[model samples]
Target: MVVSLKESDFFSKNRRALAKWISAVEDRLPEGLEFLQRHYHRVGHAFRIGITGPPGGGKSTLINALLRVFRARYPEETIAVVAVDPSSHLSGGALLGDRIRMDAIGLDEGIFMRSMASRGSLGGVSEATADICDLLDIYGFDRIFIETVGIGQLELDIISLAHTNLLVLSPECGDEIQAIKSGIVELVDIFVVNKADRQGAGRMVNDLEYMLGLRVYSGEDWRPAVVSCVATGGSGEGADGVFELVEKVESHRSWLQARGRWGRKNRRNLERKLRQNLFHYLQREFDFLQPLLEQKAEEVEKKRLSFSEALEILLEEFSRQFSSSLKKRKGG
Candidate 1:
């Protein structure tokens, strides 16, 4: 018997249950799929911020620090963090230990953290991360933080999902000309030069400022700010102050524009997932017809069956199956 999400007496309203519901959606669970179409709008209220930088740039430390800062400020609200680490090619599982490093925060009642394996997805961690965020939103988390796996060009993927994108770099990243570029430098809403105590950091900041000065921005929103800091020692006393500046600039109009972009991206992502799932379902439906595709040289190989004819036969086969199932249900 096929599982049905809506018809069954299930407690999908619970937080953990909702999370499980999202996992079901990830696998294209027919039972849980109906709820998503009707309730998706109700599940999106949190302010999403994406954190991304090159590996070894202290991204985890920065995220840890932000959690502390945000938690202290909002005593009544819960925060949800989604950390993504790419799967190891050899093992096909993630070696993600953001959970290990973030143990202290998870102990709190107000924080919920999850780690996702990239699963070879280049754009989003899983094709389901966005949907997973929607699940968390329905559970009542107000601030959503997504930390991207610091793989090459993957930073772009993370920023696209967030309202405010912070590009974390170091003072030594670029030489005199700031040669070593951050992956998503152009899209940065805030540029952080972490580990400022090191040499050449000062020059790095200057080079970034030089580049920013040449940029043209006619929008009322201020140009992206570059802040320098040491994530380890609480360096750059002013570094913590930059976040408020980011918030002030992100008005509803700005947010709507960002969501419009996200909406288009979501459409593309959904289409891709639908096509993949459709192909999988089709393969199972046509298992008995596999021999037709693998027909041997002597008999049907010489017949040279046209592609159009094969499609026609497959359509008829599925139509028959569907019609038969409907008739059987009606008879009962």
Candidate 2:
């Protein structure tokens, strides 16, 4: 029988149990996941907001600021932040900084901070981010904030998982022209100019204005707004909506189809987690794949096999292992 945790159990009496439960949930363990699903109904009422941008865009600082506002405005509300970032190359498999960046709100008893390392999973996201959001939502968090890695084009995946996609940009980001890039412009809901006290803040705002003008002329009804923030100050930073520069979320026909993609998207996301599980079964975490990849490299070096042939073997092994994993799950 499943052990039922009561409210008293959550209040210091069973603190360690709660911690382990949360850890298990973040890791996406199958056994621990059941507790979440069974109790999800208790946690199913929260708004999920997604914040993403390029590296050093001040997303962490901005999120920290947002949490302060939320706490003051809605004093009774509970908030949770899930930071999805790659493992620091030097640190092996841990976030570059979660406690440091989130120092603004981490100490708050009302705010809960959780960092999920990408651990080499690609697509610029944490595999469990959305699921964790859902779990936090059901767990009674009033607001759930998801912070994505700001690297390359892959980070945009946060759009499918969040109700609001706040695309944060640093005032000094490489070039102003990047604002008009099709892929970046389309997915961003709110354009936040973080580190606004910096020199390029005005120029960055002007460049964005020019870009938005071109977009306004288009038949698109949804107009993305640009907001300035000084995230380091922890004031109006990441406060993209503070200056009336907020994207009015209207129900768009196209966007509905776009937003509706979540259902299908979640399915694919679950499949990815499943694949991670299958790989873990085959290799016991990181051992199998890297060694196999290394062997493939050696084979290629000696002309023993082509890269395609090596890839085929890997795929075949994955398929075989995946089928076996499914059977184990069935038997379990």
Q: In candidate 1, which residue ranges exceed 4 Å CA deviation?
A: 1-15, 152-154, 175-186, 234-332
- Positional deviation of residue 296's Cα in model 1 after best superposition, in angstroms: 21
Cα lDDT, all candidates: 0.64, 0.66
Highest lDDT among the candidates is held by which one?
Answer: 2
lDDT of 1 by residue, 1-332 (tens): 44334322233334465555655766657545666666667754676777777666677777776776667666787888888888778865557755677643867878877777777776646656766676677667888888888753435466445666776666545532344354345566776676778887788778778888877766644477777766665413454433443343254326446547446544554565566546646666667656644553223446666666666766786778756756885894
Model 1 — which ten-residue stretch has the worst lDDT?
3-12
Report the error of model 1 at residue 85, Å: 0.5
| Collision count for each candidate, in order | 3, 5
Candidate 2: list runs displaced more than 4 Å: 1-18, 40-44, 88-93, 101-103, 152-154, 176-181, 215-221, 232-324
The true-versus-predicted C-alpha distance at residue 51 of model 1, in Å, is: 0.7
